[model samples]
Target: MAKEIERKFLVRSDEWRTRAVSSAKLMQAYITVNEDRNVRVRLIDGTSARLTIKVGKSAMVRDEFEYEIPVQDAEELTSSAIGIVIEKVRHRVPIAGKTFEIDVYEGFYSGLVVAEVELESEEDHFERPSWLGEEVTGDRRYSNMMLATNDLASELIHGVSHQAL
Candidate 1:
């Protein structure tokens, strides 16, 4: 099983935009979300699709299993997803030998922008770009799974502040 170790942050500025090497539109939905595991289906650029299963309890690391699937199947699964489908454009920006995935959200999450960097190890150190905002690595509210299932208004009303950074 492959392990994924990553850190998440809110975007502070648009400086990373011009430095991005590429961007792709993505739509993903969770088929199942539980405390221990989650099953997700993602359609990328309306052409490629993947089915991903993530297991583990830690926010910083998880055992991830991902496989390519037929676009038709992904589309079907997305339609029957449990909650809101995630829509975003992912921009790939490279800095200091690491790549950061900046997601510009769309649909109900239009104004949210988040950046994530994968690390080889949980203790690995990485450069923090000036555009990176507050670290939200362990914040469940910023997790894509939670973002997909909960109402954004409730999140804000309940005091989960998305502060300007």
Candidate 2:
């Protein structure tokens, strides 16, 4: 069994932008591999794909399992998804000695910027950048999987102009 433990935080400022290296801009289609539990696959950088399975009894510690798969397989599974499509550009930024993934969303939910940090363990401590805001680690709305099912741009943030610098 693979366990993925990580902490999520909101971006606090645009400082991280200048430091971020543009990774890739890709269109992703997702489906509910297990909607009841929160398991899904994300295809990034065109051909690279990852299957993320999150399981946990509480919000603090979640067992996340990520596996690499073929993008074609992942695309085929998108048909199994309940509904909705998500689009975003992934950026890699090094902050606080850790690599943070900053997702700048587009398409239906544009102007939404979300930053996520994966930890070795749930209790692992990390340097929180000033640009990081409220912690939405446990919020399902911020989860990439749920983001596919719910158009939460309006729900996560009212209206903001999100762009990569």
User: Taking the tens digit of each residue's C-alpha lDDT, what string does model 1 give over 15-101?
Assistant: 888899999999999999999899999999999999999999899999999999999999999999988999999999999999999
Candidate 1 residue runs with Cα over 4 Å from true position = 153-165
Q: Each prediction's Cα lDDT score?
A: 0.89, 0.70
User: CA lDDT of 122 in candidate 2?
Assistant: 64
Q: Which residue ranges in model 2 land beyond 4 Å of their true spot?
A: 26-28, 33-36, 162-165
Question: What are the models' TM-scores?
Answer: 0.93, 0.80
Write model 2 residue lDDT over 1-165, tens digit each, in one string: 766566676665677878886678756555543644666766776778877777765544666677888888888766576556667888888876888888877787676777888777767888887777778888867776667776676777674544232
* Candidate 2 TM-score, C-alpha based: 0.80
**Clash totals in order:** 0, 5
